[model samples]
Target: MFTSREGVTLDSIAAPLRRWLLNPVLTVPAALVLSGFATATPNTDSIKFLVPVCALVLAGVLLSLNDYLDKQFANNWVSDNTWNWDEEIVVVTGGSVGIGASICDQLLARNSRTRIVVIDYAPLGWQPKQEETRLSYYQCDLSDSNALRSTCERIRSEVGHPTVLFNNAGLVRGVSIMDGSYGDIEATVRTNLIAPMLLAKEFLPEMVKRDHGHILHTGSLSCVTPPALIADYAATKAGLLALHKALQLELKNIHNAPRVRLTIGIFSFIRTALISGHTNVPNFLLPLLHVDTVGEAMVSAVYSGYGSTIYLPGFNRVASTLRGGPEWFFRILREATANFRINFRGRHEVDSQTGKILKA
Candidate 1:
């Protein structure tokens, strides 16, 4: 007879394994190419393929080691065994729709004992039935500093100080640097980068005092290799990468709060309203991810009770080492994809004054 643990389902195990095996992350291709060489006649010409195979193996091992070290180093090599879901207050920004909403749902499903406080300017997409008091919604524009502050204060007085913060809310103008207005640039920066910093300022002190909390930022591949036409959005994402790394350092050195875990999710394009009409041509190496899949990963990272640098689909982790490679190669690769957003339409717009999404 077959059996399983409380949360260990077959899909959970098989799905990740399948994704890893099929990913173009050196291992699968290396195996196939190496096998072809081994089966070929013992000639000098056939042996040339070994060069690429060796490089692939080396790259694969290095990336794997980097991934392991990142997680271990962020957690200070300490395993957290003191997590209590009942007392934790989870905060999700942009929780009204798409991936954010999915995260809110999964968090509730993961543990019925925890409370969730959603901060977004839009109305909650799902209705909570009576007696389901664990979820609360706060309508506030993250781009507006004053509004964000007031809303956080309300959350503190109404629910409690958030022990877990998800900086998932973001906006994109989808225009070239010269084509956008000053307001568009400001709104994008404020929403994408500034808001997360301010939110950290509000809650991080409390987390440090208690020495127990988690902060997860939703980052983008633009941080790794920014494409054309989305300069403002990409710049903010790069800033986010810097902010996350800096916060990790400060949390360890200044605050001395190793238990205050910090995690960042780095992902590519997704099937969300934010990029509804995006004209990105899909390729095997770069696939458009599903919102629920990414949301599940983010929620799982939080439950792990450790800081992590999450790269969804696993294959995109190579982006971490891309800049360190040859400049000519990077330039050629970037130039080839320069027109990625040439046909993409702007799916959303933000109102600078009211801090609400005028068009989405």
Candidate 2:
């Protein structure tokens, strides 16, 4: 159950201030203002004045660029247009579990005219709370090319062309490269990377013809700050980032489908069954990302029709900027901050003889 917002307290009053302090948009400007204020003295120091002025201008320019980048994927979802959720069809892969299921829940919460299709080989253990009429499921093993083709064709005939595709299916074997099998590598790549490619090939042509669609690639923060464990998992997520960027460019420049949006979701460790056993950074510093927050954000993007890399906790936008630093810096930071559960890797089944992970 959710708490009602009828009551106002001291914490409620401070909420706006907290948000303002935390937002990078406001913080950048605040930093510039502080720098400028310090220079407004009677020291007759022209260097200080010039430097602060330049800094403020640069800050303004960067902020403007950031705003433009938010709409970078497309000019598709304008606020004033006659476009609506009622006319949309949403397709989610790996939608039977974890973050994927949460996204489906949010889409149904809209209770609008949008239709939803969930493609997964795994049978659903739980149903949507919304008791939806616009949602359906298809048993498709996404890693299997033949299964994907047949299932997608069925979806096309039964439901319609999916206007939005959430490439959310993923897996984590949680073993080092030296410990993992070739089969593990193949499965990880097929599910995480290759499946999305096939889905696009099947669906993107129609979207381009109509010049309308949104593709959301749910990537991970690991793409930038990779840990020592889960080598194949990180590789596939990093591939998502690359594929999303390339797809967006193809939609914009080559195909002239500027309205076809491809958004990248770069989130940290989200609390879900998908990564339930995985290690995390200290909770005091980096809390586990709630499913509700991710669901709400994804639904908002789908309805609103703009796309870009969405960082969880909002503060994770820093991760993109941090990528420009030296590789060793990130390695040290990862070890110091999130090294606690790194050893816990897979399930609790180690080989008694060789002291290696028994199941990979």
> How many residue pairs clash in each candidate at the backbone level?
0, 0
Off by over 4 Å in 1: 1-67, 128-133, 277-282, 339-347, 352-360
Query: Where does the lowest 10-residue lDDT sum fall in candidate 2?
Result: 1-10
lDDT of 2 at 193: 93
Against the reference, the lDDT scores of all candidates come to 0.78, 0.70
Summarize candidate 2's per-residue lDDT along 1-360 as a digit string, tens digits. Answer: 111122333333434644544455666666666556666753655445556555655655676676676674245334324346776888998788777888888887776457889987677646767543687899776767888999989999999998899998877666778877676666677778999999988999988888888888888887877776677888899988889888877877799787777787888777665555434554433456677767667777767767766776444567667667877875666675455454424232333333332332
Candidate RMSDs in Å, in order, are: 7.4, 7.1
In the range 188-226, model 1's lDDT, one tens digit per residue, is 898899999999999998898888899999998888778
Best by lDDT: 1
Model 2's TM-score against the true structure: 0.77
Q: Where in model 2 is the C-alpha error above 4 Å?
A: 1-15, 18-65, 72-82, 277-280, 342-360
- Candidate 1, poorest ten consecutive residues by summed lDDT: 1-10
